[model samples]
Target: MGQRTFAEWLERDMINAYIMSPDSALSPLFLVERQKLESMLLGEQIKNIITCEEVDRKERHEKLEKWIRRLEMTGFEKVPLSYNGRIEATNLLQRYSHKYKFKEEHDCLLVCWSDRPLFSVSAWKFRR
Candidate 1:
């Protein structure tokens, strides 16, 4: 009849049986949704809702800046530019070329890694 706390919902539904660990970080959207549900149970209006993707993007952006700063400070021969999305990679390659300059002849490389060991390192050269 009333909204439940996350703990209450978990206990009532016995959700712990399926989770790897309850201590794992929950997405911001989950926290917001939980708060909204709790508020609704207490007869309050829902104020806002946000997706987990937005939260993850913002966090990843912050991490990218930190990495860039660290790489710059350590005087790497080439700064590493990390991107989580295709759009971000495209925009950076277009607008920030001077900062992330690569040789026109060897401008792109792709590295793939997985948990298994029998993998080959693939490289690609892109013409600007």
Candidate 2:
């Protein structure tokens, strides 16, 4: 995705969003993991947005739908993510922070940071 598209996602909800703030109550290992992840994402933002690149203003949802349609054209069918797997993912996130959320919709697991969806995890299989 272009930097503009990526920035729109951040601008839409990430502003002032404290989705990954480290908590003193958490274990030191978890805190370190969170810091590392934050650093990686920040580095990406610096590379993509801070470098003064052209920004594509296309709607992100439209782009995502276009990709899904392309995948369908390639004979890939959306498969429901397993319930047990979703449960496991939920449990794991809950162990870290309740700020993260998972919503099951349209056979995909939507992972949200706070109220906005960060990304989705879905299974796909080729139709024989």
Clashes of each: 0, 0
**Candidate 1 lDDT over residue span 4-122, tens digit each:** 98756644333222222222257989866764565454321111111235544332222333544554566543423343443464456456332332222122222211211211222
- Can you give the lDDT of residue 9 in candidate 2? 60
| TM-scores of all predicted structures | 0.17, 0.56
Q: How many Å off is the CA of 6 in candidate 2?
A: 15
lDDT of 2 by residue, 5-86 (tens): 7655664344324335334577879877876676566544444443344464222332346667877999999887777988
| Top TM-score prediction, candidate number | 2
Which ranges of candidate 2 are over 4 A from the true structure? 1-63
Look at candidate 1 and tell me the lDDT of residue 41. Answer: 49
Q: How much lDDT does each candidate structure score?
A: 0.36, 0.65
Candidate 1, superposed: residue stretches over 4 Å from native? 1-61, 79-128
